[model samples]
Target: MFKSIAHSLAALSDRFFHRANIRLKLFYAMLALIVALIAAINGAGHYIFNRDFLGYLNEQAQQRMEDMVPRLEQAYREHGNWDFIRGQPRVWFELMKPAIVEHNGVVPPSGPPLTPSDLTGATLRFSLLDAHRQLVIGYPNIGPDARLRPLLLDDTIVGWVAQTPFENVIGAIDLRFQQSQFLAQLIIAVVAVMLAAFLVVRISGVLTRPLTRVARATHRLAGGDYATRVEVESGDEVGRLAQDFNQLAMTLERNEQLRREFMADVSHELRTPLGILNGQLEALEDGVMQPDAQTLRSLKSEVEHLNKLVGDLYDLSLADAGALAYRQTDMDLLPLLRTSVQVYGERFSQRGLTLTAQLPAAMPVHADGARLQQLFNNLFENSLRYTDAGGGLHLQASLQEQHWHLVFDDSAPGVPPEAMARLFERFFRVESSRNRASGGAGLGLAICRRIVDAHQGSIAASASPTGGLRVTVVLPARFEEQP
Candidate 1:
């Protein structure tokens, strides 16, 4: 039963704390600490009053007893008998007051004699008696523990003055002072806790409001609302977090736009070839065209174009999924470069373009020969398809800084400066300069970029010196193989 109770308490507190947000948590923590401190101060009040304050009061009582001796002796000498002060209440108070021209440590002295009212109920316990030990007109209850001092006249004992000291003086005062002090502490603690709670609420709210907004925006973003944004009002970490969240949302929105465009372009590209093939087959079905070599070739060409587009799309998916296999070996790049240039030379010439080459004798590198060949093929195709008639492509390879530097500069029909940065982006083409009529779906350069990245190299596109586009490829001589 005890174990179950403990477990239940633990679970209850855990639930409560978990459900509380940062502002409430901070406010509760700070308020608890301040209340505990105030309780501690109030609890120690008795010890302080007993060990220090009460001891000082007792010492003063002893001093007062001594001060009264001289005044009583002088009073007896003046009256010669106890008749003058035997029943006088006013005279009794005068004698009860201290004869010293001084004051309590706190209350300042006004004139001559000082009053005994501040003695903490000690004055009312004083009494006078004759030499025969008979009680006079003061406190009636004098017990055996009463302190007595003699009145001597010419060495004869005349009478006595008695004061019964309280047995538990400090403990008695403790009761009276404790109640008053507890009330004061309760009021002060309440005010202090209230102020602390107010400050904690304001501060914690300031710190967590931005974070709360970011969390809400993130939830909306996950729900496909990519356009959500947060207002930044401060330069603290919370503000920076909001800024980073805004940037992330912006990037996701742009990517979503690109994804829609990519689907539309793929559909258009597929429909063109498929529509041509469909029309040709329908014509053959209706006997509108004879089955000749040229007619078959035209239908075969449309099927081949559709097949190539599908193959390119499949290859891109494999590359993006990191499933594209690469077989790396140490090979001289000069032969590979020469072979690709020679193979594409006829095509460039057929298109009324010149293909020039500047090859080093032997450039050694660690690379995948087949992928590098594909990268070179794509670069050449981009120039051949897009450049107008009479323009040519210039290929240059060199060794610099332990890297294979391959640059291609083609003539005429330059890319726009704004489009250069996005040249390797998938499905991006300069419609103003390199029209859609001359280019495939724009996946060639993006695939080239992925190939370069796999080889742990870099590729960039800029303006060609020959008034066209320039492509620069840099491959490190040696690198670790990445999985």
Candidate 2:
């Protein structure tokens, strides 16, 4: 039964917590805390004040009784027994009058002598009793709650003085004061709670505003609105988050633009070759063009262009999916570099450009030879397409602390510094018109980057000292056999 009750309570608490928003929870928590603190302080203050006030009243009553002791002794010394003062109500009342003691041992008048009627409504009430406990004067009925103090003369009990308990009257006054203070404090607490609640709500709104904007922007982003952005207003973590969100949106926008451009470029490239093939076939069928070697060669060239485009697309797709095939081996890079340079040297010469290579005897690397060849081929093709006639191309290789560094620098008309950073982005072309004339598709550098990355290497492009493009390749060197 206890376990079930506990479980039910826990579940109820959990539901309440889950349903309450952060702002409401914080406001309620702070309000409850402040109220509890004020209640505790007010309760303690009232308790302490009442205790001390009652004690002070008791002390005053005792002092008034003590002052009457000396007078009673003097009155008894003059008159032999109770006959002199027994029937004298005025004398008893005068003896009971509260007196003030001064520094010079002089008894000053406290106030006008209190009458028997005044004692009824006083804060401290008293009764004077004879030696036999009979009421001589003052209040007739002494209640059980009254404190009794004996009047002594020469260590002999002559009579007794009884004081009414101060608890009732002082408590009434203390209660009135306490109630007034409680009401005032309650008002102040209400105002404080309201102000605190407003501040809490304002602060929570400020904190959640950026998050709300990010959430809204995310929804817009999902709806294909990549241009959505949020305003950044502070230097805190939330502001940083907004900045990141904006950056992500900007990147998505750029990628979307690139995607559209890639599709258009692909369609155009395929259409050109397919259209040429269709036109030539139609011409042949209509006998508009003879079935000569030139006509056949032109058809073959278009087919080859279509095949190359399809293959390049396939390679890029595989690379994107991380499914590209690689047959890595420990091989000397010098042979591969020499062979590629030799193959592209003629093409460079045909373009009226000079190609030079400064290679080591043998630099070993752990890499896929075919991919390396492809990477170098792409760099060479880029130079062939972009470098003007009479431009110079230089390839140099060196060993640099566990890595082999290969640099390809060409002469004249280097890429802009800003554009150089984006050289390896797919479908980026510095000279769009020249690329179309050269029958180039601008995926070469991107593929080169992918190949180098797959080999756990780095590739970068910069402006060469000779006023042309510079491409640097770094590959991890294979340690030679110690034998």
**Most accurate candidate by TM-score:** 1
Displacement of residue 449 (Cα, Å) in model 1 is 0.8
Per-residue lDDT tens digits for candidate 1, residues 1-483, read 999999999998787666788887887788889988876876576577666665565455556666777788788899887888877889977886864543355554564444343446566667788889898757778888777888788898888887766544336566777678788888898899889888987898888888889989999999999999999998988888889999999999998998899899899999988898888888889999878999999988888878878877887888999999999988878888899999999999999999999987788888899999989999999999888899999999888888888999998899999999999987788876676475787788989998999999999999998999999999988544799
Q: How many residue pairs in model 2 have overlapping backbones?
A: 0
Off by over 4 Å in 1: 39-169, 436-438, 479-483
lDDT of each: 0.83, 0.82
Q: What tens-digit string does per-residue lDDT give for candidate 2 at 1-483?
A: 999999999998777766786776777777888889888888887787668866666666766677777777777767746677667778877776645446488655766655333444432377777789888767665788777777777788887878776664456776897689878998989898988899889987977777778888999998999999999999999899999999999999998999999999899888988998999999999999999999999999889878877888889989999999999988888888889889999999999999999999888888899998889988888888888789979999999988999899998777777788888887778763334466467788889999999999999988799988899999999997898
Structural similarity to truth (TM-score) of each candidate = 0.73, 0.65
Error of model 2, residue 411, in angstroms: 4.4
Residue 190 in candidate 1, Cα distance off native in Å: 1.2
